[model samples]
Target: MIGFFVITLGPMLYSLYLSFTDFSMLAAPEWVGFDNYIKLFTNDPKYLDAVRVTLVYVLVSVPLQLAFALAVAMVLNRGLRGLSLYRSVYYLPSLIGASVAVAVLWRQMFGSNGLINQILDWFGIEGMSWIGNPETALGTLVILNVWTFGSPMVIFLAALRQVPQYLYEAAAVDGISRWGSFRHITLPMLSPIVLFNLILQMIGAFQAFTPAFVVSGGTGGPVNSTLFYTLYLYQRGFTGFQMGYASAMAWILFVVIALVTAVNFWFSKYWVHYDD
Candidate 1:
């Protein structure tokens, strides 16, 4: 327990402490009070832009990702032919989805001369630079988020199976349509699972870095459309050597996520059903 505290809590506490000071990698940290936070809120347009971009990314990606996952999970739960093979195929993306290799592949696929534009050309549409244009670059990241839905799909599958078959039978006896049964019976029962997925995906989206870093060529580019908060924090800390400011940014992110999670849990009380 002591070792665990030293390894995990120690670094976190140190970073919290560092958040209040001015530190570059070269020199000892000097106490700066709330100056870093004040500067960030007032003077840093880049930080504000990063925050806005990150919120947009999280709001768009998390729900879409969960929706896609739930849809696929429903299909897979129907006992399809070659179930094991299909499951393996679906799960493969989640395993390597965050890798730099996957990001590069995504970039190639979305580039002007890539497969997507070639497909567009087949339909008599002009090829456009999807990742190069600011309008479309963020959409590409959203697609990437949706593409990695396999993990949540698997979780939803497990939750779906735990739902009682008797409940469906009861709904059938009540003359409920399939959609009606799903809405009232399935959805309420699965609300807890949905909430779980929502929180997890929201946090993942908030902290997303690799896709933006690799796909944007490490500039968060095409006018910072892909400039995620974590990526910006990395640039400030490692690239610019503003460790103190980066630490402050990180703590702000932590607080934001905590508040969001708390709000979610508060709302869940009204909707998330527990049979017990």
Candidate 2:
């Protein structure tokens, strides 16, 4: 209890108070009430841009990541030879995908005249700088997020294992087609796991900062195409020294995530299943 208060609750309360003030780290915080929030919504175009970019990143990446994870998990559940080795090899990306080193490598690979362009050259196809163009910069980040699907893949694999074999056998006996069996048996059984992975991946995608920061060189550049909400908050707080405004952004993000999570739970009854 003491640790929670000290580590979580205390800082949160302090930040909430700071959100209404004007703190620049070098000077004492001045009480400003709702000014920070009002500016954020009504006056700050860049903040609105960040919100749009972040929403695009989250909406596009999370569903693709979860779908890819489920597909890989289903493939691995087929009892392939050296399953453990394959699982470990596939899982490695999730462990390092968010690292600075990986982000640097990704930037290089997506840059003009880099490996991706070279590959395109081999096929006599033109390739532009994926990480440079405003149109495609966010897409590269989405692919990166999708590449880090190992964690949810492992979870889906476990859930697939727990599904009753007899249900599949019954479907087979009833002459169900492969797709039908998957739809009626596999999907229903995996719905709960799907919901679980969706919530987690959605939240993580919203909080993502490293890839955009490193890929865009901390500017969220190319006309702010990759300006994630967190990245903008960091710029305000740490770079621009607008800590109070940053605090307001942080609280807004917290509320948005909470609302999104609540909506997911509220809608889960329509599809998510349980043993009960």
Winner by lDDT: 2
Model 2 regions more than 4 Å off: none
| Model 2: lDDT to the true structure | 0.96
Model 2: per-residue Cα lDDT over 1-276, one tens digit each:
999999999999999999999999999999999999999999999999999999999999999999999999999999999999989988999999999999999999999978999999999999999999999999999999999999999999999999999999998999999899889989999999999999999999999999999999999998999999999999999999999999999999999999999999999999988888
Give one clash count per candidate, in the order shown. Answer: 0, 0
Model 1 whole-model lDDT (C-alpha atoms): 0.93
TM-score of each: 0.98, 0.99
Number of the top candidate by TM-score?
2
**Ten-residue region with minimum lDDT total, candidate 1:** 83-92
Per-residue lDDT of model 1, residues 1-276, tens digit only: 998899988988899999999999799999999999999999999998999999999999889999999999889889899977887899888898989999999999999999999999989999889999999999998999899998999999999999899999999999999999899988998899999999998988899999999999989988999999999999999999999999999999999999999999999999999888
